[model samples]
Target: MRTNTFLFTVLVISIPYSLSADSFTFFNYYHDHMVLQKSSTGTTIWGQSSKVNDVVHIQIDNKEVAQTTVSSHHIWEAKFTSPSDNTPHTVSAVSSLGTIHISDVLFGDVWVCSGQSNMEFNLHGVLNATAEFADSANYPNIRFLHVHRQYSASPLTDIDSVDAVWNTPSEKSLSSFSAVCWLYGKYLSQHFNYPIGLVETNWGGTRIEAWSSPDAVRRCAAFGRKRNQYSQSQLYNAMIYPLLRNTIKGVIWYQGESNAAHAYKYSCQFLEMIMDWRTKFNTASLGTTSSSFPFGFVQLAPWREGEANLGFPQLRWSQTSNIGYVPNGLMQNVFMAVAMDLPDFQSPYGNIHPRYKHEVAYRLYLGALGVAYHETDVDFEGPFPTSARIDKSTSILTVEYDRGLHPIEVRSYNGFEVCCVNQTTTFCNAFDSHWINVTMTSHSFASISLDVSSCSHGNHVTQVRYAWRESPCAFKQCAVYGKMNNLPGPPFTYYVH
Candidate 1:
């Protein structure tokens, strides 16, 4: 068996325990040629090989596309992620020694999830512990590649993997994989039944900056505002850049608890990361042309509620505000499914890690189905309302949605605190829907349009909101929705919470 003994952690170097790559005990071989997106830059054929420096050649769309060099740590990663004209094409790669050859690679979508403890929370302890789970063993199609986490001050080309492989969910592997990703994958599989791959590159307790590249963040003023976050790109260099050309669906992120304190800046920086990731890959990086690059994410769930010290509500509000700042992109729909509503599931104290992981995965699934699959017929909970405009004369709050079928329904916001424009920015202590329709005085714009049918015939309405002390829209319990079934129900489909 091969082992890597590190001498110093400053550089986070890996020392070889054996000369032969296959001799390593932990990783048998990476399941390769995972995600090949349509119009991807260069096709990447990644996976573990028999030995280090094993030459790999890729053939995609009936053409030879990539060649790779294995790092001394015995890691093999290569990409030819350029997509060609949105056509379905097959890809194949063979090792020089003929030890591995993977065929039938299709160009579709791929996404990577990397962050801190919240992002790293696994499935075992959360919802359905493996002991209680059914036999959900292999989905050879939905490849899962587990990345080894490395922390250092400087940039790194590659990181070593001791254990993990591309396989379907098993009793053994189900526990280690991200509970959120599992749900997302389950949704993807059930929604489209396409081959899904999850490249788990997250680390516990790490900051968001550690996941973003130094160069990408430096371009934005928001990232520059923080001193330490800008200084390091080791994780980015080692993890993200290497996988750029690899075909991936859009991202499904679950992060931001660590950055909750600085909510305003996260709005700007988070948008930057989304744009940067798109720009790094497709020709039309910013919008739907990049297959709409469905960048959905789980809104931060209920945690640290009513805490005197922790700013849980504020953090969640900042998270929900992502819809406002990101512009046009819809919120990744989950919150309810992951059942943060279950009273027993919550920490009940100051705890960031919630036990209800199944609900988290379920919510992610609903999100993937809504965005990536565009399964509008399925009636998934999705595409939350991003903007609500109150029209005085018409007595209608014309609301435009970020996604989903047009002509959406706007209702009372669950969690909101009224901030009166009259006072000196002092917020009122109220548990009411902040955004509501007020009978406009009618001297305003005569052309304003709202979903006029839904509003009451006549009443004095000023604003609308999913109001709570925090910004997330929840009413009955600390969390808005509960139970796995309600996540995809018609009533909870498109609320602002």
Candidate 2:
């Protein structure tokens, strides 16, 4: 009887502790020792732990940052400033009562990589993924924090997937890396060797509104009141809100499929969202702005009419137009290895997924070279037209771009036809005729000169549009690297400078 009672009593006490160790109870284990990593060199983190005899040991980079005892309420807290460089650090608290360790601790540039299906597409789906994942091995220095998908009006402090490890690439877990982000990190890691952290937070079918906060959407001029429907900040509540105060390099965004039909709104409104994100991120004493955060991203890849969206085509054009509004350093850079010669642009036109994610990563690498690493000679952008001159009597149109490789091929995509401002063009108009052509054939000049004797005049002599009608994405003059072909140029709106 004595033996039976003694055994029963021990079970009563041990059960709670064991369950706490293995289960998700009593404040998410993730939240219990919630880590606040790299706020600002000027800021500090403070929190409370609820337990008795708890010996709280605060750690950074796997070493002790601070330590203390739990109060009567069994709670404790700590504070830290931003890290010195792009180095990863771990933060946690282990009490006599329990233990907590957060994975993929990083101190360097941390960016939230988000988007829809393409953004959600993982490393495993990309070509050479098996080899890349295997060869890259585990990157203990490059950490990744993935937020689980959840819908909620109020923000959540403790999310579903915690203790997320920033392990190196491998066949088993590499599939989780957003192909774009993984490749981006590989390029940055190889060049900088600074700790790189990726916060993977994206919903497969999410719209731009879904990823934004209610307040952010409300502020957008285009969303108007309708934005309220998906604008309650549900995503940030589940994703961004929970990871507040964690410093970041910038955001790599790859969305817009849901609202592609509304690219016009996206041009300005989307940049507004970028402003919002930067405002939120920069809100910290950390004070990092999107303008300065190195927010570079992919301009969507080339896709044929049938595969993904049937026959619609304005979406891609809208994205190209928006690039003009995106801040200089933070935009769709075309000069790099992004879409140059991607498989999607080639023969197998049916596959919607561009499995060669490495190319996307390659583009990002170019962006980092120019942005984060501060390399000036990097070429990851496209030509910006600075001025234009129209000579009606001479039948010549001279156009100058802000930047270019020069002697670039000019044409209407799918053989863009030239027509007069009065009459619509015929099939013959689509092909280059006596009216439209390229001139001044040297690569050294910054501007391309074309003779338009055969082309149509626009609303006035003051304005002469080139290929003003709908056009395809095909351009023969892509850079030698060819990443710029995915997005065809928009019908240019020229003004004399």
Displacement of the residue 166 alpha carbon in candidate 1, Å: 1.7
**Candidate 1 wrong stretches, greater than 4 Å:** 1-42, 46-109, 138-140, 220-231, 281-292, 308-314, 320-350, 378-414, 421-497
Each prediction's RMSD over C-alphas, in Å, is 10.3, 11.8
Clashes of 2: 31
Q: Across residues 69-123, which tens digit of lDDT does each residue of candidate 1 receive?
A: 6666565556554553433345555565554444344344455666666567776
lDDT of 2 by residue, 170-284 (tens): 6665667678877787777787776666777777756677666555666554442332324546676666654553456667777665675565556555555655565555553
- What is the lDDT for 9 in model 2? 9
lDDT of each: 0.48, 0.50
Model 1 TM-score on a 0 to 1 scale: 0.63
Off by over 4 Å in 2: 1-48, 51-57, 61-77, 81-91, 94-106, 138-140, 162-164, 221-232, 284-292, 306-326, 329-351, 406-444, 456-471, 474-493
TM-score list, all predictions: 0.63, 0.70
- Weakest 10 consecutive residues of candidate 2 by summed lDDT: 4-13
